[model samples]
Target chain A: MSIDKLSGLRVLCVEDDPDIRAIAELALGDVGGFDVKLCASGAEALSVVDDFQPELVLLDVMMPGMDGPETLRALRAYESLQSTPVIFMTARLQPDEIKEYLALGAIDVIPKPFDPMTLGEQIGGILDRHSGTTGYR
Target chain B: MSVNDVQASLVALRSKFSGRAREEILFLSRQAEKMSEGKLTGAELSEAYHVLHRLAGSAGTFGLPDLGEAARVLEKSLKPHVERLAATGVADDAIAPVEPLFLRGIEGLFGLVTDQPASVPDSQNKTVEGVDDDSHGTQVRILVCHQSADVRLSLVQGLARYGFQCLEVSLTSPDLAGVIAESSRVASVFVVGEQQLEGVASECRSQNVGGRQLPVLCLAGHDSFEKRYWAAEAGAEGFFSEPLDFPRLADSIERLVSERRYRLSGRVLIVEDDSDLAEHYRLVLESSGVEVRLVSDTRHLMQDLAEFQPDIVLMDVNLAGRSGITLARLIRFEPRWLSLPIIYLSSEDDPESQLVAMSEGADEFLSKPITDDYLVRSVLHRCHRARQLSELMNRDSLTGLLKHALVKQQVHKELASCRRLGYRSCVAMVDLDHFKQVNDTWGHGCGDRVIKALANLLKNRLRETDVIGRYGGEEFVVVLPGCDVGQAQSVIEGIGRSFSELLFFGNDEDSFSVTLSAGIAALNDFSDGDVALEAADQALYQRKSAGRNGVSVYTVPE
Candidate 1:
């Protein structure tokens, strides 16, 4: 089944920096009503991703251990996660980098220094677009 | 958790990290003291860099802005020594330039190390994500993840003199190895610390599987054969040892990263009625690794474009029974070809003709009589810029595949061509099976790796005439012109089988693979591009519903 919105989705938010991770949690979990499980590094995310059974993975491109792309590569190895969508959230999501993520099967890229208040909408919009739905972008 | 609860946790967390930050800063200061007193060596310097880098990255976050700035200064001072150490495996001897600045940074940092401030500094009140305080703005960024602050500083300062942007990340960054592999902005990485050297080097190697691998240079304690051999085993491009040579190391770094990034390879399309001139132009460019395709007939320009898809077009302003300006304008009318550069080559060196050519969508006008060297350079540079700009506009950043909208336009163009000319063309919609599971099981990064692996495999295996594009999510659309249903299926099936067999590692140990489903719609079976695309989509849906990881061709119902 295709998912279209951020609400009620179990998400794995992977980032290296503690501050950024906390903010992402607040934006995704508290503000957007997402079930967000935060990881401090790509390695930690990899260790917990299968058990978490997250519907979506929100990754920070430049994380510590496995990095976003590496983590995505690792996740693809598991048969159970081959269909799950991954969205990259990074400060360095420039045009070229976004292409890199898209090539890696990232649903979309959310630029860094995001507005916490509207992150839910941005994420939802991308997911909705991904699932071929339209409404509250 | 509530936003308020998370915010409160963040506040409390800041203080906790602040305590550790102060201790780390104090220890880093002690290393600086030793370096100042001339006790610097390869091993000792590497450790200091690690501490200082951690301080620089964390101090600003833990409520000590001034300390972070000072660490930045000190890191800059050590840049040259760091680059030299990692590139050659030797810690190059360095005369600290602007020693007062390093001393000043050390003094300022001591204030923070000795006493934890009650309030966070205003300058770093926000996340360091947008902080732009560094003066090295013009240099190409060269990141140094080292163990010694002094070593990184010397290396950075030396690199700064040679126009390199220096960024320092902590030794504990899990993705330190990947920074070069993932980020295009990072020209190279200088790693000095001994701990995790092998792991970091391996990560660098792993990230470089598809694209240009980031050059990883390790800083070693000695120039021993055993040490170099170990470094090579760990996937380091080169190891710079202590008591190193700075200039030569700098040159080596440039040769490895910057010089390679700037290497020229392009395909130029030459449209000149003069067969001799076109071959001459093609020959000149071919020598420099630039592929050249010539079109002597003006009428077949569009057909050639659809086939070759060259980086830049070299056209004569005057064509046999046609105007070059008219052709250029027609090319620009199509959305897919909007940025396709058309350089007018004309013997009519008149300003009026050049102005007219420019107005009608020509990029450059080379006068009738031009030297081979000038023509080659002009064509190379134009093609290079066109490719770069095209990547920014038409290509997706990650896989370097054509964008969704751009792909659709390409599909339409290929369909129109098939309709006009009696040639068979196939539109194949490809989707990766269980792609989302790849994201959930490993992470987005792995999912991306699978996607990229598939994309690269497709590009490598498929013919150049086949236009491939990422049509969002795990879906891709390929326009295989001049190929029938059977031919397209055979080609796609081979690609799908090869892709699944390709090994994708989950970690140090776990490796897996993925498969793709292809649905082919013969253009001749449909009325238009959209209908053909829909037929392909329906075919894809049928395959997905009936167990995926296979190809199904669409057949017109009687």
Candidate 2:
């Protein structure tokens, strides 16, 4: 992962579990070489998205307070993030289950027990497909 | 199963498995089992625990020395596993050692069991077999996160051979929850190994990754009943003793897919006098795979019945002057539609009206202030039942076309506005010239033949966008939307000429033909509908006076 790919990229990660959060940060930040910020709740993600000014967001579908899909909904309220590529990370989803999330405008979903090494790559691939270019290099 | 039975079993299991790590293990094991059984996270696990805890204490009191001693050992062992998993974000490797021992203990108890229900032992039977249908095969999505990319690919390739859509999530860097959550987007099942069970479940639960409720078939390397039970507690819906029983796992997935398919896809029928309500109903239902139809007026009950064939006729009971009960009664009286579900929707709350509506054959009645959820459920229930009825009755009333019941439906569209924003609606009444003479001269048969010919001619001459309705004998009403007097006159005149050109023959009489006189009227948007009809009727009379073969435009007397 190069800084050029991640140079101006900003990402908001919403996850309630710390171990999962840490691994996501490492993958999207160091391994993927992207700028990433983390929030644990849907409400928090909504409030911080503008401040973080992220180009992309990796949201976890389930959270203690506000889950991933709800966070995505809040993300949609911001005109800037409305069209921003969002990839949902969930363990309990099936391709069919993603229909509602996709209808809500998520670019893709990444299953749980994710591989730390390729987490960035998978997200980058989805972003690339949706925006015609990946913010990550 | 009864809560008490579950409790007793848990108690017996707890007492049989007590150890230093017993508490966490028992809790985790029971929870994982429940999860694997398809219970969503936030499911109450305490009941199961209360039973086990009670059993552990009671076993000692009952003086079944071996049972008491065994339970103590199990309980003591269960607690530490929970601690280790929560602290380390992974299931403890310690569970592996107890696999054979736990199974042996369970079997030993089963062997000694006296009078326990046989059904209780078959708890594992609840697991759903996934996506059945072998000849064509199915694409089962698998989420795999392991240390090696090779391992992931190998699993993927293997699953692909079985026609599965294999999605690989690597676990090397941790964040197992994120990976599992992401997997939900692609795979139907997440196969987490024993080592990653605790972390995966917690993370998944947080993400609501299937609420940790969807099937996450665990593959354990060892036959560890303790670990299996632990995996179930963590929200895995199914578990496989490892070496991966691919066939059985596939079967489980098949069952899960079927279960999900059977989940409700609501059906709704919106009987709305308001076009906007009808449109809203269409929007909500179509998106959710609901079949919807709209009937603005209750007068055309039979027409609506024959066409729409809605699972539930969602009626705007108080449509204009007609009561919904009248229409419901009309439907219920018919043998074909007697049991048809009719849901009366109204703003009126008179108990008398509700009772009348119910008596009139409405299966369910809802008030106007209905939530989207309630509307959805009511329609779903009714429509589901309606679908079980035979297929002949689905048709539409206004145009005498097949109703939304038979065809896919779109919202009742409002007219595309014209510049005159006011009631500038055009009404054309085409009546026969000396229609009584034709009836007397050619016997009623000639008159009937001529009327049919005129109907056909008017239909052909008018613009396809126009609303044409048969208005009694020899007279047809046509609504030309967005049309002024000029457009209406021209269309009506053309139909008049076509009616004259129509050649008709009676059963035993000479060939004869008839001419039509049309009255066209355009009303301002604010004009009353009845006033427009009267004006149009007056103009029609004027055309009759003007030698009967042309059209006369109505001009409001200033």
- Against the true structure, whose TM-score is highest? 1
- Per-model root-mean-square deviation over C-alphas: 25.8, 25.5
User: Best candidate per DockQ, number?
Assistant: 2
Residue B532 shift from truth in candidate 2, angstroms? 60
What are the Cα lDDT values of the candidates? 0.68, 0.56
lDDT of 2 by residue, A30-82 (tens): 65667889887788788787688888888877566777777777778888876
Worst 10 residues of 1 chain A by lDDT: A128-137
In candidate 1, position B259 carries an lDDT of 36
Q: Could you give the CAPRI-style class of model 1?
A: incorrect
